[model samples]
Target: MFFSAESGQINHANGTQYFRGLEVKEFSEETATGMMDSLLYAPCDYVITQSYTCMSREEAKKAIKRTRRLLMSADDDAVSQRLDLDVALDLLTSGKIAYGKHHFSIMVYSPSLESLVADTNEISNALNNIGITPVPAEISLSAAYMAQLPGNYNLRPRKGELSSQNFVELAALHNFYPGKRDKAPGGCDGFTAHPVRRWLLYQPA
Candidate 1:
């Protein structure tokens, strides 16, 4: 048995299991590559990397390009409503996308609609630019949890025109939006992409 997070391995043979804490984390990338490479020479009947695939590399690229055009031209109102989508996509390209045996969840916390929408395209473009094909199904935390868990969240517009300030307020709840108190000159004065997730444990009624 092996634990990826800590990179520990357990060896069991001869009716006994030996436990050892090897310096596996430092060698994880190389070890993983070596193991997978061995599969090229001989097939092994085992699972690898928990297996996450959303769309083919080609599909993700197409989806991202289409979405990016929409973002650059979308109205402030539309941007405010769809930002969570963008963050989720960015995470996918960052290799943060995860899936289970059956269901998949795209997790982002407190995302403004605009950032979510825009960042998704950015992530898609980033992935395509890097040549890693990802197939990710999309899900929104707010829509999924609103009825069960809504909070005192509100947005305020900066300059009363651009949606930047409004989007920042919406994103803070998720820890993805950076504070507007200070920013670099000539840099985007609005929110940037940060992605997060929350876990819910519901009791049966």
Candidate 2:
């Protein structure tokens, strides 16, 4: 079962639907486990879970700025660029934005969707200022759909795992496990990282 964003209708499919501009990749159980492990092991910056609500442009911009600063301060340039901070900023400022009650999460490290009905000119201008190509609604919708896949996991490292300070200071931090450690059957230590520190874990009723 899948959905067709182009037609704006849910469609049933025996196989995975390959929509253009959407990233849909099949992974084996081993691969899926690895993906989840990588995310689970990484450090995190911030974990925010909030009720569904609309934010004023000012509030949104402030949030965006904070996220941008955090990303930039990180050691990984890819992390700073991959989240598309500019697009999120534009969406927040687009006005009248609302997320549904069932799922309106804004995982900082995950890919998200902006309203298709937002003003293209405004979004384009915002992207242009950041030197990012404007992504069309179709692509954005497809990306959002991909994120909903059960096999797909968007993970970020927990705070204190990766220091935003200078390289020297970051290296000086202790290498102790951030969470409780469990002993595996083979006498190996197992660590469980909490990426969703404050987020709700939604499940079907």
Candidate 3:
């Protein structure tokens, strides 16, 4: 839930040595809706979504809509700092993509991805839509989510080495691969600057 360097000023608090972003005091549709509204005015430089599971298209649509509302109205400071990002990959509503709820996960800086998938033509028409790109959940999930998991657990040589296999498989469920130490061009295994650049671009001016 927290990325130190990626979190900017929020990584450390004046009063506390460590700070986690956004403690949820409440959870509900109204709260979610309210949060979504806030993010639009305070859009992130980049909004990344990582999933260890697949989301229905309908769910993806709903997620994109929520993201759009947030990115569009996010405040300049928050946007500049890339705050208030909705990063969970879970499907918000129920049902199937074709007949039920719409669900989408994205790594972008868009007001919404629904248009990209449902209304590509309209997306082309909109100005300043760079943040609106809709990549498959797998790409971002592989790159962002899996790559960010803390591998820094307490190590015990006598207890045997920590297995990255579980981590790798879990990430793969959502189409992600474990961040590999080896550097390969366009490799999905490790954290890279590409995601950061995406975030910075949408950062408020």
Candidate 4:
């Protein structure tokens, strides 16, 4: 009933190196709740959701410049040496570039306090594995959950400073593209994080 982690859709057996998505030792009872999102409201005993929002161009530019200036004047010599900041600054100064920041929020819900706590802890740890620090939505839990819905972008609880490039890398958007490229000699077909398992295959009783 479980997927075999070893078999992946990406067939880069030699040259390509795939980014390690997550490194959790085990899945939770609530693991299925977070991964699947549906348009219809099929209320469950628990719900855990997260959202990432892209900032406006003007706001992002100003924020980027302000952060750069602060780093430029800071006494720490290492802050300016960070490659992420340099790339962001170059995008702004080099010429016209599409760049922005993203605000994000995560919410975990359960009918009982115990499951809620466990699910939140599991999800938070998973997020941390991929370099995201989950901050509890103190006074903004409702807003954070609501923000997961479409047209509720304004409900994001915190101002996310993550760059657009970083967001793209984190999201599945940059994973792999399909087209004539797939038809090309070395190109791959659309891939999935989950691949079929022998245990799940049909067998005669």
Candidate 5:
């Protein structure tokens, strides 16, 4: 994919385009509820893409082995390594955490190129305030955009390992503020659009 000066967007040979993509690299050590904090008031159009794939039992074993090997190679702190292993063990045994891999990217779109930049900065700042780190997709912009497509996990955009519990926490699944419908009685048109978000899980291929 390449940036088009004329269109002010990343352009594919086939004509798909996007203004910009920011990836969720790491979250702050401390996070609060509502991952999409200020997004509700976004003045420009945007998308929050999230894909999650549940790991098979064999995949979990391999992941644990790979993590242990990495820790050994890096000579990480013993306590840190133990903590990692403990979480893995807890996933395998206690089953409190559902093992999975996920991809989370936010794409902002606007007719004005300058607006795209400003909106991106605003979104990033808002998320940073809530302890989320979103960085430019850079070379992975194409892959990230594609990964957001429904049933497009087969392309295998880069993902980070996480547990269901952790995903729910990062996703702020507990954030629920119901609003009145647009045409409800008594002038209760508080929300413009209220969408029901559902988590679509895919069994590992």
Candidate 6:
């Protein structure tokens, strides 16, 4: 796998590639060559290369289930709510939840709409305490969205699949070129070309 800092893309010869703790798609030979040419003409601060083992679909599903189980077990009324809030704060401070580069959305799954409505203020305050004052419009909790949450957790590389060097290089790059807190969604910020699955556990905030 070859990651280009200039493009923020993870390119691979074939199959899938893992970079920065995420799984990105493979690039065609022609496209990969063109990317290389572009990088040569406009050099970037760093280029990362690595070898990794990807997780199969069953393995990925099992991992997601395990994560969900852990989150559910940890969530126990106010105690778990406070813990989740603290985790979000810690992630923000550690640069894991950068504004535009990587942002977290709270997804609440309740048995009924009334339950969600009742917990709205509690959720809002938790985010507010961490300096992330989201507008009412940004919060959404529905059976439809909740049903799809498990799918969103799929396709991530298994833990320890990536090398230590990959983490080091990614941390260095983020330090030098930390993404802005923009919400427009375009360019490399979206990372649409080489989509990668994120590892954040999506539990109610």
- Best model number under TM-score: 5
In model 2, state the lDDT of residue 184. 32
Off by over 4 Å in 1: 1-53, 74-76, 98-205
Candidate 6's C-alpha runs over 4 A off are 1-100, 137-205
Give one digit per residue, the lDDT tens place, for model 4 in 72-169. 77855765345556676677566545554355444444434455556556666656554445555545555555566788877766554655444444
Work out candidate 5's RMSD over C-alphas: 8.7
Q: Estimate every model's Cα lDDT from 0 to 1.
A: 0.30, 0.33, 0.29, 0.45, 0.67, 0.32
Clashing pairs in 2: 42-157, 43-157, 43-158, 44-157, 44-158, 44-159
Cα shift from native, residue 198, model 5 (Å): 20
Query: Who is ahead in TM-score, 1 or 3?
Result: 1
Better of 1 and 5 by lDDT: 5
Per-residue lDDT of model 2, residues 84-126, tens digit only: 5665555545652422211111122211123322323333343
| Full-model lDDT, candidate 3 | 0.29
Tell me the deviation in Å of residue 35 in model 3: 6.5
lDDT of 1 by residue, 1-205 (tens): 4322212234456332211111101111111112223222211111111112245434554555566667767743566434644654565456655221111112221123344344444443433343323333212222222212324122110111112222232223222233334354544444433222222222222
Residue 191 C-alpha lDDT in model 2: 32
Q: Positional deviation of 72 in candidate 3, in angstroms?
A: 40
- Candidate 4 vs. true structure, TM-score: 0.53
Candidate 3, backbone clash total: 32
Clash list (residue pairs), candidate 4: none
Sort by TM-score, top down from the best: 5, 4, 2, 6, 1, 3
Sum up the clashes in candidate 4. Answer: 0
Worst ten-residue run, lDDT, model 1? 22-31
Q: Tens-digit lDDT track for model 3 on 56-99?
A: 55555565556556666874344532232232222233331121
TM-score of model number 2: 0.23
Superposed Cα deviation of residue 10, candidate 3 (Å): 9.8
TM-score per prediction, in order, is 0.20, 0.23, 0.18, 0.53, 0.70, 0.22
